[model samples]
Target chain A: MKRIDLDIRDGEFISLVGPSGCGKSTLLRIISGLEQQSGGSILLDGATVDRIRPRDRDLAMVFQSYALYPHLTVAENIAVPLVMRRLNTTERSLLGTLLPSAKAKRKEIAGEVGRVCDALSISMLKDRKPASLSGGQRQRVALARAMVRKPSAFLMDEPLSNLDAKMRVQARGEIAALHRQLGSTFIYVTHDQAEAMTMSDRIAVMMGGEILQVDTPDQIYQMPLDLRVAEFIGSPKINVLQAALTEGDVLSFTFADTANNRVQAAFRPEAARLAGIANAPLAGVIHHIENLGADLFVQVMTAGGNLVVVRCDPGGIRPAIGDKVGIVMDEARLHVFGTDNRRIEGSYRLEAPL
Target chain B: MTARSFVSSALRHTALLLIAAFALLPFAVMVSTSIKPADEIFSETLRWWPQKLAVIENYTEAFSAAPLMLYLMNGVVVTAAIFFLQVLVTLPAAYALAKLHFFGRRLAFGFVLFCLLIPYQAIAVPLFILLYYVGLLDSYSALVLPFTISVFGIFLMRQFFMGVPDDLVDAARMDGMSELSIVWRVMLPAAIPALTAFGVFSIVTHWNDYFWPLVAVSSDKYFTPPLGVMAFRNAEAGNDFGPLMAAATIIVAPLLCLFLLAQRRFIEGIAFTGIK
Candidate 1:
């Protein structure tokens, strides 16, 4: 990773969001001490933990595959960390069963396992092996295993990626609730922006091994510092148009194949409206209409041959395919980018048509 | 069942029965010859049923003529020792070859593959000389030590361990298990089926081994079952066919009983190893 620096606060839920191969999961692994970073050191609670082993790091990890031991029952799987931590070598042996202290320690361990299972609502599955559990159940078991220790923090690598769509939504809510109940630091990594947006206290947008921006989900969606961040954070991505800034602070954006005239501005689909051709700054033929029950998104093919999607209210006037219409940009909602792809600072009104 | 399926099943059963009979013909002849009296054996008119049964006498003579019990004990000791040592040596080696990354891992595995290509018998004379130099000949060490580091065992276990997911091992490490503990506690349990297959292969080969024991040990005390059988044939009653067959039966009985007891597991292990 190149010049990526992030600070996760105490009891905070932070998510690393990016496309695959963006080093999000790699950064998480480095934090967990599962993978070592070549150049940097990791500090946990003001102590350098980079050289520490994974077991000694006082951190728990939930893997994407939910790597539960298949031979162990759910309860035993959860008890593994406890057993390793609480018992000495001799106490973990078969002969240790005959020792009174060992028995007492085992009972105590069992009680903790029971409590974690009960908290996760998997108390009934304690006796079953991981192979027999469903994907969602296995995920809970993996969570229970990580939670049994009450570690300093939890590092999860795409923990919900394997679940079905419906299960993923429910699991997301459960994990958020779990974080609240545990009140522990969580560093979650995922390629899904929606997951990051909905669950994180703050989202760190990473790209090409660098963290582009770190802010609350609202701030990221509304005020992206870079163009790639703007495109990656939103669905039906923020529309980007090639444009030039002329004198009088005027911006002129032109579509392809139209060198004669330049239209001024770029805006998100929700920031544009269908208007009458005479007054609209840009004209296009409606290519497709998508009715999503509550809102409709209309795709327009402009005269300069660029496709622009406009989000319109379902109750309002809807245009059919092949209908010629003009697009009116919402002046206040328009986002202007300079040639360097940086957000332009000043705002100016459009010129009135003659 | 349908009429056509019934005919096919009948044909399959008939073919299976013929094959089974063909396989069992030798054993049946050995048992028949073992129980037959001297007069019935000499008057050989290909009669399977003996005119007079001499079960007790032939079996007792078979035991008494040679120290058969001692030889069986020796076979048990040597086979068990070899199997235990092989697993002790092979499991860790296989785990390392399958999982651990090091500078010379590929080269080490290449050497293991090269070792597999060389037949053990081809090296027996050199092995015997080595044992003699080490003063281990005519002892249990000579019988068991040469077979301890089994290349076949390592290869079989390496194949099985390769199928074990790396996630599980990493999980174990995260759970605070040392690498050695992971091999025994996690990998060993997971590789049980393959280990069982290798066990059968190892035990049967060592138990029935004749050429190695013949070359390695010269003393009667260290004689294995095959050598014991040889001693029985070299005795005065070597021409007595009934006791000879009885001795042969005794020598082969333990493995037969073992195979019968674990037939399902043995077959599953062998089949799993074959598919992989």
Candidate 2:
């Protein structure tokens, strides 16, 4: 990962958001010390934990696979980290059960496990094995294991990816609520931008093995510093149209033949409006319309041969597939990216009359 | 059942019964001959039952013929020791070969596979000479030590361990389990079926082994069950088929009981490796 400079604050819910194979999971593993980085050193609470073992780092991790011990029951699985931390080797053996101290420690651990299980609302599943539980239950067990220790930080790597869609949404809310209650640092990694946006205090959008931008979710959605971040953060994807920037920094979209100073104009589907084909600046034919209960997303194939999605109110201007339309993007919301794909800073109004 | 399926099922059962009888014929003869008197053996009319019963006499003679009990004890001690040692050695080696990343792991595993190709008989003479040089000839160590590091056991267990997920190992590490603890606590519990399968193979091979014992030891005190059968044949039990077969049945009875006791686990172990 080149130039991945991220400083996660204590008690901050930070998410490393990116597409798959963008080294997000690798970065999480490196932070957890399960993987070694080639060059950079990791700092944990002001100390360099580069040479420390994963368990010694006082951090908890929730894996994508919910890597609970299949052989152990839910209670025992949750009790593992605590048992390892508290009990000595002799006290953990079978013969050690006869010792009074070991027995008391074990009972204390059972109580701790019970507390975490209750917190996750999985107290009834404490006696069951992981295989017998559902995917969501297993996820809860994994979460219970990570949360039982009350470590310095929690590192989750797509913890909800294995669940169903409905379960993922529910789990996303629970994890965010859990972060609030624990008030410990959480570094979540996910390919789903919606998850990252909903759960993170600050989302670090990564691409091609480098962190492109890091900001609050509102800023990431409103003013992304990189074009890739803008494209990746929104569902139904942001639309891009090829255009040229003329002199005096005026943004022109009508003429198609001008090739000098080419810039890609991008906007979210909600930021653009669909109007009549006669008076709007950019004319196109309605390619497809998606009705999602309260909103209609109209995919218009512009005359310059670019497809743009414009969100429409379901109660207003219902257009069929073959109808001609025009896309009038909000001038202030249009992000202009230069040829290098970096966000260009400007406030150029549209040349066409509104 | 349909008539077609009934006929096919009948044909299948008949074929299976024929094969079963063919396999069980030697055991049936040994049992039947064990209870027969000398006159019935030479009667030439192939009688499974004798005109006069000699069960008590044959059993007594079988017991009194040679030091059979001592040989059976030796078999137990040696086979148990070998199996225990093989498990102790093979598990860690298999876990390392299957899970750990290090230099020459592939080369080490290749050596194990290469050793699996070499038959025990091929190295017997050299092993015998080495035992003699170490002054462990005619000793229990000679019997148990040579078979301790079973390459076949290592190969079987390594194949089984390879199917175990790397995430499980990483989780164990994150849970603060040392590598050795992970082997014993995690890999060992997960490898039960493979261990049972290896146990059956190791016990059967070592318990009935005759060739190695014959070449390595000259003392009667170190004779295994098969050696006892040989000694019983040579020591005043010549031409006495009744007591000989009785002794043979006695020698083989323990293994039969063991196989029966572990029948379910043995089958489960043989049909292994779906641990997901």
Candidate 3:
């Protein structure tokens, strides 16, 4: 968590995207005040809340485990935050109903719980416990509980990681819609890049303990500032080729220079295509082919012993195994990195065939 | 069912029935002796059914011989007070030992486990001396206060509370519950099975305790059921077998009824705590 400087805007959906153990969840916990950060201070709306307790911080969190009280029914679970806030100690006790004020407040809390349940379409599950509900239903109940509080911000840690694939997709849309309707600041933490890319206004790609880059999903995919960010964000990973900038300012894929002008050239599978072996800058042998009914991905072993995946059309001419083919990358889509792994912003053109 | 499984099942049932009857033989003898006339109890041949029934006389004589009802009431008061105070003390202590992170937490839990090793009788003399010095001897406080801090209850509850998830605690904290409220509102409800198990252990141990009562108090008015039975034997029902057996049966009847009512929860609690 060194030098973590993120300024999330109001009503913005920002995602902390990283692999496991990358300190994303830790950062979220620190923001929610569930955990303390030893070296940094957290400010909410220009006010420092480092010493504030989680209850007073006024931020709601949806844990990955759902964290619903098993003994409480769905409605009671949803009403917990409100009940704790609105009722005094005596009013929250067993004999609270005897007090006129408490009874009226309890009715108000019940109405809030009912409204939250209705908004989440979980009104029918109000009386049922979390144990009896399906994974998707319990997730909604957890959402309902967090939403019922109407906090200033929502901190969710992999909220949909427990659902089945189909439910995860459905829940993804529901959460996105919820963010739009509520228009509150949402800080989501997840390891799945697809979740971050699809749902977030700005995705913060994290690795090790630091945030590598923060940008919109489209910009993050097309123009990553860090080499690792580009490699981590896309499925069927981007390919990195060992290349050297020779004397004539030519990019040679097979030649490794003894001088310090060495660089790593990277490109996505869709940015490169197959060409005649004599005409392209790089050549490779087709290693394997994956046919997914609508798309074909061809894995090629380059002459420099690097495996690069190329996305090909299923209706195009399918290349056979062990055939040598030329690799022609979309020059504009190529991401060039310097020796220090920072993206080099320049136009790299192939002047002559390798 | 297959013949082999049937044979095996029959053999198992037969073995269980033998052990059950063996365990129940003393109780059956006590009940049979309580209902029989004195001369029939002394007969050479063992007979379950009494030739002359002395049920009414034995029961009336047992009730008249000593204040059995007062003894039962004393038993109820002492055991209930001890159990209630124990739960009041045990819940917070166990919650801290199981969940809270503090200085000397491990050391405190170690002390609890150490205390479980020392039986009550070993410390009974010091407890009696302490009660005497405090001028609480021969009173209900003497009976109840000595057994209030049950180390076994703490250990049992701590073990149960350890199984509860930390996420649930965090959730409660996020919901604005104070730590004490979380104990009663969340952990306590989830720990009912363990509480029931500890309750059975505490109540039965205290209700049937004889040595503690004998040493702690001297007044016949403060006598528990076990002490009352002893007093009844030496004072009024000397060598009166039928009345004595009747008194013994009456003293144990309440506990038996209670055990029957809580049998299911007791078993569930035992299994939940991983203690047979």
lDDT tens digits, residue span A241-291, model 1: 665555545555542354433333457899889988888767789999988
Candidate 3: clashing pairs of residues: none
Best of the two (1, 2) by DockQ: 2
Q: Which sequence of candidate numbers ranks them by DockQ, best first? A: 3, 2, 1
Give the TM-score of candidate 2 (chain A).
Answer: 0.98
Report lDDT per candidate: 0.87, 0.89, 0.91
lDDT of 2 by residue, B168-222 (tens): 8878888888889889989998888788878888999999999999998889999
Evaluated at residue B181, the lDDT of candidate 1 is 85
lDDT for A207 in candidate 1 is 91
Indicate the fraction of true inter-chain contacts that candidate 3 also forms: 0.68
Interface DockQ of each model: 0.65, 0.69, 0.76
Off by over 4 Å in 1: A255-266, A336-354, B1-25, B38-43, B47-51, B270-276
Deviating ranges (above 4 Å) for candidate 2: A255-258, B1-10, B49-51, B273-276
Candidate 3 - CAPRI tier?
medium
How many clashes would you count in candidate 3? 0
Q: Which candidate is the best by DockQ?
A: 3
